[model samples]
Target: MPLPLHHLRAGIIGTGFIAPVHIEALKRLGVQVTAISGSTKGTQALAEQWGTPEVYGDYDYQSLINSPNVDVVHITSPNRVHVEQSLAALAAGKHVVCEKPLGMTTEETAKVVAAAAASDRVFAVNYLCRFYPAILQMRAMVQRGELGRIIHVQGHFFQDWLLKDTDYNWRVLSSEGGKLRAVGDIGTHWIDAVSFILGARAKSVFATLETFHKTRYRPTGEVQTFTSQSDPASMVPYEVDTEDFGSVLLKFGQADHGHVSGTHANCAISQVAAGWKCSLYVGIYGTKGSVQWEFQQPNEIQAGYRDQPNQVLTRNTAGFDKDVANFTDNPGGHAEGFPDGHKMHYRAVYEHIASGKSTPVLYATADDGHYEVKLCEAILRSSEKQTWVGV
Candidate 1:
């Protein structure tokens, strides 16, 4: 009575670095990469790289969205474009899987959520880190109260690419991405990862954001950077508008604080630290003791409790909760990384479109994305106002 998965078609709107990964993951699931849309010739070429046949050089986003050939639209557009593009897909009545910070502002994020609710179309955000088998185990422990009541939560993400003066991209521009800088791009992960795991929301944040480099230079003016090698001279001069280093003191209240307090809590993110290649670390202090995990060592979850030796929970290990255990395709010790998370998320979204259903399974819904943006906004407010701000 249902159509087979291979019959479904997915259209990808951006051919940026992240888009290809989504395309490949879809291909692995046997979903047709029906259409590729991009404004740049460079991106169009990228579409062909993946063996996708259809290329709309000056792609009409709305046209591709409403086309009968496409069943789902994946939005991998840059920071400024995420909200508009996702809204377009929702307007067309197609399902959507948008990247994080679904909107530049939390208010805009609410619009996306409203759109999702009105359409009855499936919607998911690309916060797939939670889908990892290891983190899922830690979440289950918190959910079952196995770790006792959560006392405190901490998360951090670091990157050094922005620290290079010669290497410049649109990410550094305030007009392109909002002003939160390192925290907006990388710190949001810290917020999302902890919130997802503890199944708690951040209420308020006491934060400070800084831009260490007041200005940067490009030897060659008006050039886009690609290639692992960036021309030292190309950086003309750009004033930094966002914070390169940021830290936040967050308080995500317990269940008894009333949903309002727990749902709105403290969280933070930062950039400009060294040796972090998208590393996400999370520490949750619970009544009995604590639980810890990090994204770099993705497959392993470290946990500790009162008077007990710390335990290492691997994917598919005995202590894993049944809900988390269901996601492990490979047995213990066979690692799953970035692509695997994307693959799992794609598979879940595909199932949603085919079955015509919504899931509370915490695959980062539009609601989650909107909430993240709001959290980011609150972080900015707290940092700017020099006071703790409520989410």
Candidate 2:
């Protein structure tokens, strides 16, 4: 297991935007955050501000992994550093929770998985959405035959953050984010969710991806971003080697039966449209009725049928499903959001270590990361050759 919660000393690597999210989750779990590491001065300052002792700004990554105070490594580094850092931490005999899309590419991701499998340590990917209360409820609903037999699933995930010409990150670059940015970064989460929820593997897909904003702005003065999120006028063109919007025409084979009736069908994921803020929209069509869920609204479940009135199922209330209803910890009126999902994820991870629960089977692992990377490659191949590529 993961040394008892009281004894677990966690250290975070890379203090970018998501680092704080990890720290906050650990706080809720009552785990200690002993140290933090980053390659940037601003990140080091943020770590100090957060009261993490023994801060390491320019320290060697391997030394940080080998630190005597650390019992687990919660990796929040960039895509490129995920594998190397994870391998180092795992080799140092620390349990690891690496961020999603486990590594820069499938080859690298598999190496991390191989290392984890070779060790006795607990290794997992942080695809936190699966632990969302609503999603948990939906998984239970599908299992209980509330939806009859899943027929078709239509998923859409989009955000307007990159809609502006000035928005840029290493993610927009191919070497950093790989050949497919949208499909790799966020799309894999959707794919992992569908596989876990519907319990199906994609058989094949036909895809089309593009970089609509071919040229982006660069900072005229010293700015935070490598290119620029400001200084729109003094912008320079950066070749977008990666695609911004990824449209995958998916076909999933028979995997889970009797929950939802999808004899054989499709779903899609798009990240560069507009106005979507980290939403996981699922439309499950079944024989008797259909259920819909959007991650943004985690407290309620939408259900519809031919003979009866459509209803909204709220948590801890009469309108909810039996499986998920059992885990409701709140009464009516309190609110839960994305961070709650992370909490649920951490709870599962903790339970796996503490109680030896089999839920770890459902959590994302490095192999999923490997397959997701291969899937992205297949998507690119299918898009280029105008043919279906099998996963």
Candidate 3:
């Protein structure tokens, strides 16, 4: 029997765009969001907005972690502090659902892996792309040999939020985000989702990265992601160190399922692609057939076959089987996109915690998160050296 998710109380650290996403998703799952910690400017307002009782301002996440009211901690802070906050949350015996890329470096992320391994708590990385029903259905098909002997995968994650020289966010800086901006921020979602569907990990990577805007302007004060500041007088110019766009080629290793081994995959990731907003596309081709999905059109997938006519499989319909039904809430024709993915992801995590870790581990673990960071480092090296680097 499954336990009630309402019993788990969550505390969130960070007041950025993704923080409210975490809060709203937890609420939808009947989980109480008791505490919120972040900058003094936004923490109290955010708490009041959600009627949360405890507010830890000035980025004081330690207090939030120590609070008896919080059973789980959601680390949505910037990339640099993920490790410190995660370690603190673990030591406090709090279950954690941290935002991705784990940390800035593999060395620091390894500590989180070790810490999570030593603890009995449930730790998850917010790679919520795995929760999409289409992705889940595709994984089921691959595992069942419906898509026989996976051949190659192709996709791209593109956005125009950072297209202009004046458009700025903390992610544009290597110091605030990681060394790789577009890849680390969104590209990993593509890679992780593909890995989940294929039941394999990328063994090596060949990447080419480019920074389109050599110099970009930012406002004197910090602004939330996707927020616009158009006045040139209020901005100052700085040299951009991170890539605005990149193309990556990956060679995946064997999966436990006999269908896939040594598969080839390529992806294009960009934050500067004009008019495209949060578009993530994935196509997996196999000997038997192929499945294609786009984030913009989350409700259906295009399944291609050589011998027969291709079909469009919509969620909660005939082609989507019982395996993916649990991940989706709405019926056929009702559109569920980005926010629903977050909700389902949190539902899976909270259920695992509520059920005493008896539920299937569908969410990304600490080790998976660590591997992504390591892969990001390898991608950076590969881009610089113009050669394939082993992950």
Write the candidate numbers in order of decreasing lDDT: 3, 1, 2
**Candidate 1: clashing residue pairs, number:** 18
Tens digit per residue, CA lDDT, model 1, 1-391? 3235798888888766788889888897889988888776845787668877667667567777877898889887777888889988988878898877687887678888999989988888998787777677777677777777666666677666766665566777878777666777777777777777776777778888888878866544333423232564534677778788877887775553222134322334545566675777888777776777778888887888679798887776677646664456777778888888888777777776776564345688999888888888888888889898888
Candidate 3 clashes between residue pairs 3 or more apart in a chain or in different chains: none
In terms of TM-score, the best-performing candidate is 3
- The most accurate candidate by lDDT is 3
Q: What's the CA error at residue 238 for candidate 1, in Å? A: 0.8
Candidate 3 versus truth, CA RMSD in Å, comes to 0.8
lDDT of 1 at 149: 65
Candidate 3, residue 66: lDDT: 98
Q: Which 10 consecutive residues of model 3 have the lowest summed lDDT?
A: 1-10
Model 2 ranges with Cα > 4 A deviation: 1-4, 220-228, 256-268, 319-322, 325-328, 356-360
Assess every candidate by TM-score. Answer: 0.91, 0.91, 0.99
Per-residue lDDT of model 3, residues 92-198, tens digit only: 99999999989999999999999999999999999999999999999999999998999999999999999999999999998989899999999999999999999
| Native-referenced Cα lDDT, model 3 | 0.95
Clashing pairs in 2: 149-260, 149-261, 150-260, 150-261, 150-262, 151-261, 151-262
Instruction: Tally clashing residue pairs in candidate 2.
Output: 7
